[model samples]
Target: MNNLEESKTFVASLESLEPMRDFVSQTGSNAGLNKKQIYGLCIAVDEIATNIILYGYQNSGIDNGLINIHTIFEKENFTVILEDSSTPFNPLETKIPDENELGLPLEERKIGGLGILMAKESVDEFRYEYKDGKNFNIFSVRPNDD
Candidate 1:
């Protein structure tokens, strides 16, 4: 098995999304991930980070919450761990819209369920936990040899 190399960053605002994406992209690339895998990683990371920016600290009026992103590159897979100091909200618990409901018109459908759904479908493994008053989300994707 190949050893794992990791990198981390702190994201405090929506403006930091690009930097966070770049960090993950570069790390994935260095870990030998192909274009598709790297793009998937970026999308998953963006959704999680954006959720934090939009809802994590809204009630507390705290604008400086910290998002800690840890990317681990192993021989067989790449794993990313995102931890945030906002309220203990778990995206994994977010309800996904029913497939049948998707055909309804936009106004008739519910809002705000696609992020976690997309992340779950795109990544090989997705998990979450709340500990020490923090929200911890972990996502993993395997290397494709095609």
Candidate 2:
């Protein structure tokens, strides 16, 4: 299938979040995603990118790291691939909060998992992989049906 694509590399730091989200938004828009879909795609990318910046880079004490974002516009979907070298983590492996857990009082809930859940739920598809010393987080979204 024919595909249109764009890619960018950013320093793995919180400062890069805005540009990262903007990249997703603009690409999603170009891919024919409506405002809400674009927003969700941005959130999916932002959440995963934030984790890569915080846990993968800063917390791991990597002095200088990078996040490479690649966007693909295919006939049936828009896909984003986020690659990083700081840590080999699969956010999808994290346990999602069950109904009982989500029903718990806000203060009693776990500190993690929610963001990843949101990131996963925000898009039509989400996948994670660690290969060749890099972490790959993939997010894809399809246009809403008429």
TM-scores for every predicted model: 0.88, 0.93
**CA lDDT, candidate 2, residue 138:** 91
Q: Tens digit of lDDT per residue, candidate 1, span 1-146?
A: 56766657675688889999898889888887888888888888889888887788656678767888888877677898888888778888788877977788998987768887877887788899899888888888887653
- Kindly report which residue pairs in candidate 2 clash with one another: none
Winning model by TM-score: 2
Number of the top candidate by lDDT? 2
TM-score of 2: 0.93
What is the C-alpha lDDT profile of model 2 across 11-40, one tens digit per residue? 888899899999888887877788877887
What's the residue-level lDDT of 7 in candidate 1? 58
